[model samples]
Target: MTRPTLQGHLDGWSQGDDLRRDVASAVLALAAAGIRISELLAAGPLAGALATVRGHHADGDSQKELDVIADDLVREALAAAPVALLGSEEADEAVTLAPAGTLAVAVDPLDGSSNIDSNMSVGTIFSILPFVGADSLLQPGSAQLAAGFLLYGPQTALVLTVGAGTQVFTLDRATGAFLLSEARAFVVPETAEYAINGSNLRHWDGAIRSYVDDCQAGTEGPRGKDFNTRWVASMVADVYRILVRGGVYLYPGDARGGYAQGRLRLVYEANPIAFLMEQAQGAATDGSRPILDLIPTHLHQRVPLVFGSRAEVERIARYHGGASAMPERSPLFGRRGLLRA
Candidate 1:
């Protein structure tokens, strides 16, 4: 049987609606840009120091050469689509694409750019929402009409959802098309793996530290089951792995100066990921709250992101709420043991 192409999928969904058609156009544009980006990344160093630090965002995140290039590529592609506002991580302000268009697009043009030099997996995450004048791009994740990500890895793939079940499509280099790979992707509710930056254990709050500690304890500890740990330092890669297999990914806020609110952007990163996770039968949260329900106060605002297997995510929330079945460490040691005050 012939596999359905991305265009075919979008065409079937957009049929007679103008807004849906425009949204489909924007998604197609993103897929086209992803193809170009995958090719550029395949060239590695031949692409001329794509990982070189060109500058820094206003928030101090280093802006790499590839980040700017990917942003330009995505913007140029969206220019032909009916996109009114473009909110990109590389841009300090949202760009007005088509003043009269009805769709607002938020994107992390080049996610995981730090992995560029290492030939690690990276991706582009996008959220499509209805244009509602000045506050169109600031709407909460729950308002998203569609969200997805293009993974440029061993095989370039597109994982998407349009208020329907999440689906996966892989690029067929020979045909130059994205063909259906997984028609209805679902996240397994339970998991025996997790991803997080373990080095920050010292700075994490009691909840995060407690969760990690329990996972580390294995069958001999509270969970009563051995668990594996995986951290690619790339959100897209880690989340993709969890979506395919079963696991949990956490980037929680800690006591650090700049990282008190977490590092991922709420609009382009966490929101889109949360939307996809929920669509795939998974869950996402900012520790104790649902990620989709959180309202964005600004475009570049950061928030703690924890997503993956539903049960694991909820358990993490319970840990945060101090309602876990695990025994407390003791008040003498403070909230997180004898680590600090």
Candidate 2:
């Protein structure tokens, strides 16, 4: 496949002018709303209190900062045309639409909220799925037609798609528009250079532990390749790294309480990331299940996340496989066979 340079991709942005207009407008809206909340935290008193829980936020507590930001962004994003329903991770119900369009956007308005207090990078992940059939806001993940995420960081970038290829757009401060950083038909590498979080080794399942063990062993392990590990405690940061350089990023389940399912929400985190992975010729899964196939049942539903380079992820899935699972075997000796007992 012919690979296009970043500039070449930017030149093609005119092709999807309509979406560009809608999404571009949404960007401004996001900024206007983001500035409001980010400014709030930037002020006194509350800032000091939030800084206490900078890296880690206790669950069931007041995430008021996140709540306001999410509500604002969702309200603004839904204002765009072709948006039918609004589903927010922070909201208790699926917001209905007028008789406009049948497109539904599921948004994680404030992802990595804990990072907000610490001045760490956070992001907004949204999946634009079909709202035509079944009329279910609690529908399956397969219904997604498009997905994207906005990283509010050093160099804020927007990664999005509408079923074609995923594209990365950087916010050009001077022009106040998105300039393309990557074009259609991008390729994410097979072997990974980095993985995440290994300290939970004792609590991890045998499969997860074995996978990391192999990577830790690197070239000496089953696969003759060097590897690295990194964990930023922020999904946006990890994803940005993987997108910039090719690597596998995982947030899987361990025996730890509240992590048995997953830490990140499914509707926002997994769905959008899954879309981006597939678009970039990478992969996304919940260990054994394809992320796009799962459905959301609760407001803040969580699921295992394993995505990035295709081959490495498939291998990880093998270890995760049990009865009636996908491909069920890790390449133990660089060959397609069952794991040695």
Candidate 3:
């Protein structure tokens, strides 16, 4: 049987509605840009020093050469689409694309650019929202009309949801088309796997540290089951793995100096990912609160992200709320545990 193409799916979804049609158009544009980026990434070093530091964002995150290039590519792709405002991680402020357009797009043109030199998986995450006026781009994640990500990995793939269900499509290099792979992807509610940066244990709050400690304790602990840990240091790669297999992922805010709010951007990163997670029967939160319900105060605002299997995500929230058992600290060491600074 022939697989349904992304265009076919979008065509059926839009039917003849003006807004849906424009959304479909914008999605196609993003896919086009993803294809180009996939080719460039496949070239590796042949594409020049893509990992070279280009500059720095106001938050001090290093801007990479390929980051800028990907931003340009995506912006160029959306130019002809019905996009009124473009909120991108690479841009300091939202850019006006089509003053009269009815859609606004928030995008992380190139996520995980640090993995460029290492040939690791990276991706582009996008959130499509209705243009509602000056605050269009600042709306909460709950207002998203559609959200998705293009993973440029061993096989380029697109995982998307348009308020229906999440779907996975893979690029057929020979046909140059995205073909349906998983029609209605759903996240498993329970998991024995998790992803996190274990090195930050020292900086983590009692809740995060307690959760990880319990997981690591295996069958001898509260969970009563062994768990495997995975961390790719790339949100897209890690989240994709959890979406496919049963697992949980956490990038929680710790006591570290510039990381109190977490590192991922709320609009382009967490929001889009949260939307996809919820659509796939998973869950996402900023520790104790739903990610989608949180209103964005600014475009580049960061938020702690914890998502994946619904059971695991809720358990995490319990940990954050102090309802879960926390590890004990010895009196000799006090609150500043001997192992922690």
Candidate 4:
């Protein structure tokens, strides 16, 4: 079957709604930005120079050269878009772009910037929300009108969801256009693979530790199934793998300094990724709770993000719930003392 172009797929939708049109336009703009970035990345020498750290972003992360360029490119592309406000990880706060516009866009213009040095996969993530009020930007994922990620991997692809379903569009380098590669992409409900930073096992909370331990135990453990583990460190790469196959990815809260709230940003990362996961018949959560139900207290609020196949996600949630059933913490001996008591 001839896969439809992204624009064609969008065009097939009923067109009376201004919001829908705006979203379609925004997607096209993003596609344009992705294509440009992909081409630049193909130029090895230039991309290497662009990978140099220029400074640091508002979030205290190292600001690479490509990060600045990509952010500017996306910002410019969406300048005349029907987007009222722009929220980005690189920005200190959300900025009003078009006061009369009805959509607000939150984006991680270049996620996993550090991966550029190693020639690993990196991508851009975006979430669209209604611009009812400034506070609407702080709304939960359920309030999203659309969400997507533009992955600049071996092949540039855009994974998007507009409430109805999730679809993947691969960029045709020759045509400079995104074509629908997967319509209503479905994720298998279970798998023997998992993704997490196992090095942080010592700092991880009981729930995450227990879950990892169970997986590590293989068929000899309670799961009665052997498992394989992988961690790409880059979320877009990790999530893309999960979407293609089936596995769980975790970036959970831990005992490390400034990590209690977890590492990944809620607005730009968790919400948008959660939107895609649920649409694909997958699942996403922050340990015991659903990621989409989280109310954003801040624009760049960090949260523990765990997502993938529904069964695997639910199993991890059960481990979290089991932790709650354990004895309460104590001032004298902490979790250990409570358990002993």
Candidate 5:
């Protein structure tokens, strides 16, 4: 139960090691900020069980608890010297970090807003790009220098990478500093257990249906290995599980009108997850191409998503198979159509 030494980690980084130092510094500072914010929420006004409570939506006059908390956390992160460009999910416009700062930070101050009101395990996500000034905020995902998430559930924790390896740290309640709990490097299995929203099954496109049906098939389907499915409305929660355990998550283009491009935001959610996934030897795609490769035409850009274990993701990719016609009914799906077809 020895904690990772924060003092040494901070003091040891040299000027040449900007990425690690900044990541370590951000982890330390952000964990402190999260603790303060969580303490305030737990004691201040979050009455009743966490599952039942709800925070104000962005449309409301008063910003939600996660917004307030995220804003404060951003401020705390900027207070550290290295941060130069600050982009936040709560704010429409990006803020300048300083006259000439070293780090570009894109943050979803409070992700999973709907769950915030319900007291579900909502948290903040941040992506660090090595850029200065306003350009840093505008630059694409390929520019990311680091990315991570902070979970505000049973125990507060941080998982981040400065381009070396993904490392996970738990916040110490007593000290307000992070101690490495999991030495993490995740390589998703070739064939993945997948995550997708099942309710929209009626609206899924041929490609998506083909993919899901195969997963549900277990060994019976073309995939030799059995499959499992999980769906969490929270992106952080889903990504967190995938980072530790091998699996795939999909929010691909479906037949549904509103959810055609899928749900999660591009700059704040997809980009960050994509950056971290590649760092950990995982992959992220919007079904057509790598998530990180897609240029954002708008800030709140939405896109189809499929990510996690490499093999599983690749298999999903292969399902789309660039064929004009999707496999609507599998040869193995003969129980229903053998008589009809």
Candidate 6:
């Protein structure tokens, strides 16, 4: 039997719900970007046509040539759809279109662009929310009616959540459509894997440092288990691996300049992924609090993001909460104990 296309699934699930047309339009825009991105990647980054667009995005991230192209493609597509305000990382302010529409869309046209030169996976992220004038666009992740991301990896996939369950769709090159591949996707509540940039270990707060030390301790530590570490640097790829198996990812706030507020943008990156995590029986947080509960004061607000299996995420939270309670001296502190504590 043939698998259902994204539109088919949306049509069936959102038949009577509000923002049906708006959601459909947004998905189409994402699908279009996925196709274009595949073509660009295949053509090779060194190609002059895919050269960097001049200057930087509003968030101060350097813009790649493909970033500019993909941004325009999505903007035009959504502008012609039911999306009222288009907020993007590339734009300084929201662009109002379809003034009468009931939904707003915020996008990261090209996430993890820094990995593009190395042929690492990157993706597009989007959040759909109610259009209550321009103000609604700044609302928290809880206000999102739908959120999804498209991964342009070895196999392009779109993982999404519509306040129900999370689902995944893979691009069928033959049909040029995103076909449902995983229904009601869920993450393992516990696993022996974790993802983080270990090179920045010294800059991490006490809670994060303590947690990493435990993982590094292997089966001889307090938790008494070995953990395999993985860090793809690309949020999409890292999170996708967690979705496929089970693991926790941390990009926490550090004391570094411009990073105290956290790095990932709340609107486009954290919010969408947080929504997916919860819908998939997982969790997401900024170490101290739930990610979806965060209210964005600006369109480009950033927040530290930690997400994955429930038990593992909770453990990370424990470390954050009990950082002060951490013993100044421990049996396992500053030394590796062969015997489990």
Reference-based lDDT, each prediction: 0.91, 0.67, 0.91, 0.85, 0.69, 0.84
lDDT of 6: 0.84
lDDT of 2 by residue, 20-53 (tens): 4444344345444544444444452564454343
- After TM-score superposition, what is the CA distance of residue 13 in candidate 1 from its true location, in Å? 1.1
Tens digits of per-residue lDDT, candidate 1, 1-341, equal 89999999999999999988998999999999999999999999998999999999987899999999999999999999999999999988898999999999999999999999999999999999999997898999999988999999999999999988899999999999999999988899999999999999999987788888777777666677788999998899987898889799999999989999999999999999999999999999998899999999999999999999999998887777654644478765323321110
TM-score of each: 0.95, 0.78, 0.95, 0.93, 0.84, 0.94
Model 3 gets an lDDT of 0.91
Residue pairs of candidate 5 with colliding backbone atoms: 53-117, 54-117, 55-117, 84-97, 190-311, 190-312, 192-312
Model 4 C-alpha lDDT per residue in residues 1-341, reported as the tens digit of each score: 78799999877762887779888888788778878877777774665697888998665678888888888888888777888899988888899888888889999989998888677889999999989888778999999999999998898999999998899999987787789998888889988899988889999987787677667666665567788998998899998999998899999999998899898999999999999999999999998799999999999899998899998888877767664554333565232311110
Which tens-of-lDDT digit does each residue in 1-341 have in candidate 5?
Answer: 67665445445543467566766566566666767656655553454232333344343423565576568766765677577667776776676656566777777876765666545676788887776545665567887777788887777777776666777777777776677777657866664467888888888876777677656666655554577777778777888888878788888776665667876778878888888888889998888588888877756667888888876676667667666435546465542211110
lDDT of 4 at 254: 93
On a 0 to 100 scale, what is the lDDT of residue 237 in model 6? 91
Global lDDT for candidate 4? Answer: 0.85
RMSD of 3: 3.6
In terms of lDDT, the poorest run of 10 residues in model 3 is 332-341
- Model 3, span 119-150: residue lDDT tens: 99999999999999878988999999999999
TM-score for candidate 4: 0.93
Instruction: Give the lowest summed-lDDT range of ten residues in model 4.
Output: 332-341
